[model samples]
Target: MPQRERKLRGHFSTPPLLVEQVLDACGYTPDKDLSGIRVLDPACGSGNFLAAASRRLLSYGKQVGLSARTLARYTHHNIWGFDPDPIACMLAELQMHATFNSCYPRSQALHRLHIHQADGLAFPWQQCKHVDLFLANPPYLAAKNNDLSGYRSTHLRGQVDSYLLFLNMALQVVRPGGWIGLVLPDPVLARSNATQERQRLLAETTIHHIWHLADVFAAYVGAVVIIAQKTPPHTHHQINWRRERWIDAVPAQAADKVSLPLQMVTTVSQDLLSQQPGAELRYLLSTIKGTIIERLQRQLHMQGNSQTPRTLACLGEYVLIRRGEELGKESALLKSSAPQPNELKWYPVLRGGIDIHPYAIPTASCWIAREQIVKPLDRYLAPKILLVKSAGRLQATLDTQGHVVLQTLYMLQLSANPTSQPETQALFSAEDELYFLMALLNSRILQDYLYALHTAYKWVQPQIEQHVLAQLPVPAQAAYTEKEQIIDRAKLLMHACSKSSSVVELKAQSYELYEEQERAICALYEIALQQRRVPDPPHDVVDEGVSLYG
Candidate 1:
């Protein structure tokens, strides 16, 4: 956006301290070279970063024993800004002039600061090559007013975000190894779906520091200021987990310390190519020829139907249904009182879907058993039947407490336990069935797939149908053992992460564990998806038996 347009629209300029903190994180030194250092603030609202840069240069010049006139001349020539708001550009120029006059009231040869009213997204940046630092927070508005479709078309396919596109423009204007910093939302850090864009940035840049300012940027919650060095695109490399948040780096000794509440911050970067080898297993598993359930059926046939077989019903037979909309209370109780003799008991219910709040299992529902109960299915007897909530904002795993029917926010699937009691009937399990199912549901790949599907029908009401849920690919029996192992490992990591004192350290360790296991799972799933055969786990590590307290 142009300076004039920004001003016309009254977009608030970033506070000066925010700019200073960002620059400091980028390793700015007051005594560094000031001459020929071109700085561009793409969304230079009122030129806050630009003005700060000028001041820093002046301080730097003074520290280096330069004359006032020399400092004034350097500031004018080095500092520059661009915004779509012409009025903003004019105000910025005024700010720049004022800053210069403070340095050299009598100097006549000071170069005027370059401020322009140009749409940065479409601007010709090639002329500004050799830019040293790209600074400023870009506008956060969606590309299209109605939906993110425009954003998908214009930015995502280019393997870039709006800010990233601006970064690309800046990179075009900068010399190799130049620095870039911007304030962005958390989605960019760990959101798994934007593979290509993440690949492009990771391939071409080095993220030096991330200032997680979730508290300070509360209006723009979950914000982080990313500091990166621009490098030429090259072969992928192993990504690192850096846990130090921007907030931690700030000190009491700095001239100005802007503190934000500690929010969870974690960073991970891995060689995209290197992951392929580990993911080979998942790939193989995903490509397998037949449905996992079907494969299990075949295995059952091979076993000569050793156990009693039962068909899954239309779902009405085993359970009753209650929609979230039916509840008049703010939140429903899982244990409602017995209203009549031989009435069904209510039990806890869980919904099925991604939840924004992690670890939030749905506890809001009133479930009841049928008045005249039919014999429980063979499948529901062991490991407890899950009252999987199919609708609402979250998806979860449910446990048996009583004769409860699932809410609309559920998936009526069954999970098995390997350790069956003497009274327990053979529920049928290839191996590690529970962990395998969890792995399929929790994989980043599956999350992305589901998210994309959700986005496609965003115009429609938020309703995920049984057909849609059924269509999701399930890995076959061959990979079930491997899938189980992966999920077990992931569960351990998650448990470990929850106990750590530092969000950064915990997430770092968590992701490392996640990456290792996820790749293996992905490779296995991939193989299954392709209808190819999969190898068994190299060893029988089974469950790690990591116990979680609280």
Candidate 2:
């Protein structure tokens, strides 16, 4: 199929190992009797799942002493597959036919096949028998107004996707207390916009296992295997979360037949996830430090002698944080950094990337004409903070040079906190206030808090949006004298960072200065860094069995 057409149809094939792994998770192994288990694949594109399941059914059917005729009849009614592509449906039917024939020869009965070429999203599922298990790798596509004509679904709400609709359909089709094993993208775990889907999943079903397979589909997305049961809410439900990684002694040159290497990292109570924001399933959050980070984020600092505890003042109330203007097609109107004769006036553009670092702005390497420059022109000229949107740590610098920053950087213009008590905030001058805030933004505590709240995967690109940064907390629990000391030190540190220094000496000096302010900041918020204890292996784990350490 053409790439565009394939994308429109959302046809990403599941690997053979992945197909068998999903089946094993669903209890469709050869050793188990899958006689009464009616398995289904809604969007069965080449019948990878249907064929594998059929083979398992035949293996267990004969082991339980069933004749070929009875097994064929049972397969006709139990194994089901559906697809919108006719060619794909034919391929699935052929695979299933061959699977049944390979187990029981001369049993190629055409009437026993139930695979259909139809859109699973709009299929008439009520006419079919009860589905005991739903096993599928559904298509993933973001839902837009023009994406599907007259497409309306209950699951389609704020910022929805096509995969969510398919998952919801499976929940409704499968019988109560049935099993649902699916290969889906990892965004369902912590996407802020997907709160409703996460809530519905937790409210309705009991999640047994979630395998985070990062980068499993390089061309597609980071995938996850969710093994859940269609059962109502119950107390004391625990989810075994695992991570996929290469084994220690395994060589990278190994053959392709080796399935995903699995490691049971940790297991946590469902209640804990349900209580968090977006109820995110951050599988790596298995320590006291993670808990402490959560507490620090929710801590309410005192303000103006108010007896009732309240949230600290946010950065948004005092700063205008906006993304850098896009260059668009106006790049053709620019000039060199040295300034061309008689050309439009050129101003240095703060090109984003590895240039702008903590307390050090990149020297302008390129210039753009004022006509090409976005207005209000003073927005770029003002002494502002240029913060680059990065993953591992915070990167920001004071832009005193009035350089126009390009896209991928956020310009933070500081203003006095409107809600602050005059007696409390009047201690610092305007310049001092800017420096103090800059120090905090580039501080270690804020970085850790942001990562803990958003992700555990440092390598993964995070959603560090303007609104999220605007919500950065500012604790105002200090006397005027203490605030002055902090502001003075922050100014000196930023000034020190602005000068040239060797990489080694700069790192050492910056760490020492940052630690000083970090201590003050932590003291202000009453937070301390909690260490992550190393886990010891349990002795009770059997051979090849995953250990449980919750």
Candidate 3:
């Protein structure tokens, strides 16, 4: 019979700065606050944080005039740790002993620590119900082994991700009004749709700090540490409450002192929105859509079957694809099933999806083209923005081509105005329409909004059908012209960048020519494309987590 192997888990040491910052935020100082600080490390692993906390508390106790023996006893009893790995629990205990002995060399009880081998997420909460501070880098394990209930569901419930589940469990173990600090992937904060519990957990607590540590994890994935204090309001209690705000981390400032009232913490991206109240421009566009849609309906009724301009594309439209569906031995072409002919002048050939972060174009043969094509304005069809609705974490790449290669994705084609309708001319300049369309896709605000909505609704396996696409709020073109110009210039910059044979050779030139506006867009897309979760804190300070920590 084969021997059983231990479960593989992501267990690593917490960075030293993280430990100090978390402790400081919780008012647990080595000498000032450690004597009575009741701390727990839920996913203790090798007790990296536990060992560090023990050292700090021991030092604090000694400085506060506690005897060496008393300090040892307090260190063993005051701090608690739990881990699912028996070996890890033993290792953590050993580490505590080593750190404890260093503080109290003559003490005998220092060798026995309170670290235990048990699933942190599964431990009976009554065991550590009074835990004042919960600080941990929990073992990230997919809830497996028929052990998915208990604390996992109690905290996470509908959340499919284990990291999120662990976060909830950690919060549950911490006493009310106590502090909880944790390191987790960036998405939980920004991804539009976090499980209800995640949003509720954040909304419930007073977040103190958030730190965006670029390339901190070996996964080289961006990470943030959230320090929170649980202080929810009672139904009838007269308590002043506010939503959480994000802060950027600055090295010089003390981590414990970071707090801003929730009312003042509106998302910076909201300010970037194109629609400002009382802007005449939006009213004009609103009037135009109403006029155009109404005019087109009448014209379509009159024209009957004639091919009046039925396609309405947002300006700056990038690629139009000729779709051909081919299985194994079938023709390798995605032939369009639309009533428009292969020679349809309105819909041009576009090939999308080949690393167009900042900029992209279709491969030579990949461009969808009918045999007959001539002149830019002759074709009336416009390419629609269609994203590959997949569950994968990879940054959704640009499908410069109009056709979607991925299965189950939606194809968006603009609804054309009837040839008789004069409103089409007033909607936007032809070139401007395409430009506007591309700008919307490239906008970070729109992307984030889409991402949030996607996350919130992704679990439903939403069919990205026409109704869904239609529901997407369209920003006013005139309101976003400045942003559009930046995107257009970036697109041009990227087009120029494609001239280079390699990224290495062109990187410096790319930076030198790129302005701040373009660079911001590039940085955001690159970060988003790589699935980095670091929240954009507009201020110079780094946010360790949600700013609800007290």
Return the top candidate by lDDT.
2
- Model 3: per-residue Cα lDDT over 201-255, one tens digit each: 5446665554444444444234557676887523222112122222334332243
Task: Score residue 426 of candidate 3 by CA lDDT.
Answer: 52
lDDT of each: 0.48, 0.68, 0.47
Question: Tens digit of lDDT per residue, candidate 1, span 87-187?
Answer: 78888888887776777788665665678887666665557667788886776443333233443336435334455456456556666788887765444
Error of 2 at 133 (Å): 1.2
Instruction: Pick out the ten consecutive residues of candidate 3 with the lowest summed lDDT.
Output: 277-286
TM-score of each: 0.51, 0.81, 0.56
How well does candidate 3 score on lDDT at residue 129?
Answer: 54
Q: Considering lDDT, which of the candidate structures 2 and 3 is the better prediction for this target?
A: 2
- Please give the range of 10 consecutive residues that has the lowest summed lDDT in model 1: 541-550
Note the residue pairs that clash in candidate 2.
Answer: none
Q: How many residue pairs in model 3 have overlapping backbones?
A: 53
* Alpha-carbon runs more than 4 Å astray in model 3: 1-8, 126-128, 142-157, 233-360, 364-412, 415-436, 439-550
Query: Residues 1-550, candidate 2, lDDT per residue (tens digit)?
Result: 7767766666777766677777776767878867778888989999988888887788787788888888888888888888988999999988988888787676545365889988887866555537898988888776662264334674355666777777777777888888899888777778776677678777788888888776555334567788888886565566788867423233422412355468555676665566566767765544433343444543422232356444356778778787766863246554444786766577878666545777664577677777766667888888888787754466767777788877768888865446554345666666566666777777767877676555443224555767768777776445566567777776666656643431112455666766777788766555221221223334432221211212
How many steric overlaps are in each model, in order?
A: 67, 0, 53
Of 1 and 2, the candidate ahead on lDDT is 2
